[model samples]
Target: MVATAESVAAAPGWFTEAIAELPEHREVESAGGAIHLRCWGRTGTPGVVLVHGGSAHSGWWDHIAPLLATTHRVVALDLSGHGDSVVRSEYPIEGWADEVMAAAAAGGIAGRPYIVGHSMGGRVAAVVGARHRESVAGLIIIDSPFQEPSGESIVRQLRRTPKAHPTRNDICARFRTVPEQSVLLPYVARHVAEESVRDTGEGWVWKFDPDMLRKRLEQGRIPPLGSLRGVAAPVLYIRCERGLVTPERAREIAALFERPATVVELSAAGHHPMMDQPLPLVATLRTALAQWESR
Candidate 1:
């Protein structure tokens, strides 16, 4: 079920409170037929857009977006097929990139903007930067596996695993079991769980289309490494030491960039470094931004 404003407002006490804390914004329309985005940040400030990984929405950045908004006009979006965005039964990774570009354009981010993405979003960001180099100021990838996604890979196979939920109550119960399944902020986890379901006659049910996983698996592949060579802006890759994206593999991928790319290994973090260690992640981002501005 599509998320209604009333439903969002009537969500659990903690989630409702969390939603209240977010800043107000004008909704920017996109041609992709998705919900117009609610944006934050000051006008004319250097733009920075955050893209989330698969099965997640813009809420994933609930913890980090506010922090980044202080410096740059940060914009985190719910890519099509996730969150409040329109549900497309068949969506491809490239289509996700196109939606981001369209959203950025509608938000008046005309020139190169700092683009940061996680997991699948990281891959989309790379494709955007490579294909639209003139519009990308810098690229920041967080814990995204740069290796090819194959049918045999653990993640790919897991996507194919059929999850059984007989009722809405069952779905909610399953969610409760993994309340802290992610390393993102607690509020983010709450938002994800809250937005993930719809109150049906029987109980709560998943809002996202299950086919999304299969589409992702079928279309998700390692983008051509050579494509990154077209990106003129410097790149910074923040990788979690024990995350899905290994340090050695990150270095190897970074080497493929035509320009030298900086890689920072977060020793005590996992896939969601921003949530696992916010301060360090923020500091690293600040340093990278400063370095890029200096150059």
Candidate 2:
């Protein structure tokens, strides 16, 4: 049930408004490849960059980004090997961090921007915060795990090269999160599913490279959380109630930071809050930024 333009136009008022606030599509060159991004709000406004999880793309934030754009310039990016971004021989988390900064500059964010990342993207954001503390305003990590599981192990466990589907409908029907969740909103899922695919001359297939992890694995090892110990930016760690990060784990991760970190939760939300609890997620993000601005 891929959502077409007609269906999105007919969606509820909130969704209709968000979807109507179209973003300016832009690309910035990175070490890996050209990073594709969608920017909303006027240039020179306070900026915030939203990053999707592994195997997910910026389209996942199509609905959420515009809502946040009311007070901030928002940019959601397709990391290399995902969505329309070029695939690279290696997929290092640090390289993804550089892409985030590059996208911010290319998207016309006037100053250092808050970097918000979900799942594996959160780890990438952590790297940005650690490496460029003076260059970033803050960091918001949503439900990212802090561990050193090998990329090969991750690829073996979660990734499978999907076969081409004969029709768009066929492909959308097969759309699922990597760590499949139980509480995805059907309308949101349908909309994202529609954007997740591309039509080749032969048929339709997912845009993300299935071998993205395998390529990273070839890099020998994924960077561990010890690198995050140097993070100096204020950190807001959002833990979804039904997501991967548990309360105990959240505290442990927070303690690793050089400064204090704030830990909060989204009630009843899954790992993919953009799919299951977008409004709450947006509200939480806005509230966090407001508090930081006042501080």
Candidate 3:
């Protein structure tokens, strides 16, 4: 759904209330660059780290993170090269994972925390679970493709510089997801779209580095099955019925994990569940966390 001024003004009470519980901003250094963090809830609570997809930043979880914060210390980070984080010469899955860990620790997560990631971030979360198994309690991957391209094909889509807009409103109006989905909440869309841009003295432009993907593609650093195989924590694989993971692929991904994994389909959601199905997504996550409490 396109975010119009009318829709934003009429935003549902829940969304307004959730976003009103503003997060505390923080910064932590990782892999030679500063990583930005947005933290919610009380300090010293169990942590939940949220990871956004490629081209997306921490604000993508603004609404969702606050809701998760009721019980857990929830933090969302701007991975290096995205959002407010400084750009890096390289963007590696391992590096992104490091940022996640650093942010979780600095954000006051009391113990081993749950890591939840969407799309490309899901792969990063898997890497964290695999490499730092003892530091993570569980993994939740939402709609990450079962496989990513390899070799030169990774850069088949040539990178382009984003055109700066004369005004922030213009930039926000032009905001669109990389792989556009059919369903989106206008209020949520407006919130993320506005958060996605920054005003350069030149003009308003997207905050994410345009060269980030080029660096990853050049290095052939796409997440590999080895990482998934290395994850030791129990997994919650959330597949949106209308999103990227197909039934067969979902099963394939679950099998890749040596640890126990459960697959739950979110009805009527797209790749971005937080955009189209925030409440249901929250309910699902709460239920899953409760079930894993005794584990």
Candidate 4:
């Protein structure tokens, strides 16, 4: 069962309309292989690079990017091993940190664009802020939790059956969030979900490589406390009220930063705010980026 054009009808008008503004694609070279990035807005304007969470691609930001593109040059990327980007033997957080720089440099995003990241991407942004402290304008981390890497999941080692669906309907039916949100806006969810798979003639499979999980698990590296304190740029930390981040944990994450981050909360959203709450998410980014730029 494949989702038809009729399904896109159910999505919000903003999303349907935003797709009309096409993006410029860039294939950035990294140590692993060519990294893919999508850009919108004029070439020389201040750049804002948006990074998606684990198991998701840049398409997750499609609707939101166009809105920000009006004010600043906006770009989103398929980090290595995810989306159409080249696969790696093993995934490293540092490699991803470098990939962000590579994409920005290749895209001609002028002068250390505002680095914004969500979930796992948030952790990667932290590494960028620390690793390239002076190079970045500022670091904005969205709803990324700090879990002890030592408590890594056992599921990564065990192999699970790869599920391929013959149609978009089959893929959409199987779609589920990592933190398992109880509710998903069908249109919003469908749009992101549609990009998550590729046609394999016989069926469609997820774009991300499973090996990325195995390799990341093998490395077992999450940004350490030192990286957090080393960040040179001003920080903006946004969390969702209903996301996996608990109030206590959010406070703890805030305490890790050397400079205080302007924290914002998205009410009634989950880990994947861009997918489910693009409007509020865009508004938060716009407001925070404005305040940062003014400084």
User: Best TM-score goes to which candidate?
Assistant: 3
Tens digit of lDDT per residue, candidate 4, span 11-126? 66777789878889889889949899999988877899898898889988888899999888888999999999998887778889899988888876888789999998998898
Model 3 regions more than 4 Å off: 150-156, 219-225
TM-score of 1: 0.78
lDDT string, candidate 1, 39-155, tens digits: 556656777788988767676666566666666677777777776677776676667777777767655553668888888788888887877778789998888886665546736
Clashing pairs in 3: none
Each candidate's clash count: 1, 0, 0, 4
lDDT top scorer: 3
Clashing pairs in 4: 1-169, 2-168, 2-169, 3-169
TM-score of each: 0.78, 0.93, 0.95, 0.92
lDDT of 1 at 177: 17
All candidates in order of TM-score, best leading: 3, 2, 4, 1
lDDT of each: 0.67, 0.86, 0.87, 0.82
lDDT of 3 by residue, 69-185 (tens): 888999999999999999888777888888999999999999898999999898888889988988899999999985776555554654444578899988888877767987789
Lowest lDDT 10-mer window, candidate 1?
176-185
Q: Rank the candidates by lDDT, best first.
A: 3, 2, 4, 1
TM for candidate 3 is: 0.95
Which window of ten consecutive residues has the lowest lDDT sum in model 3?
218-227
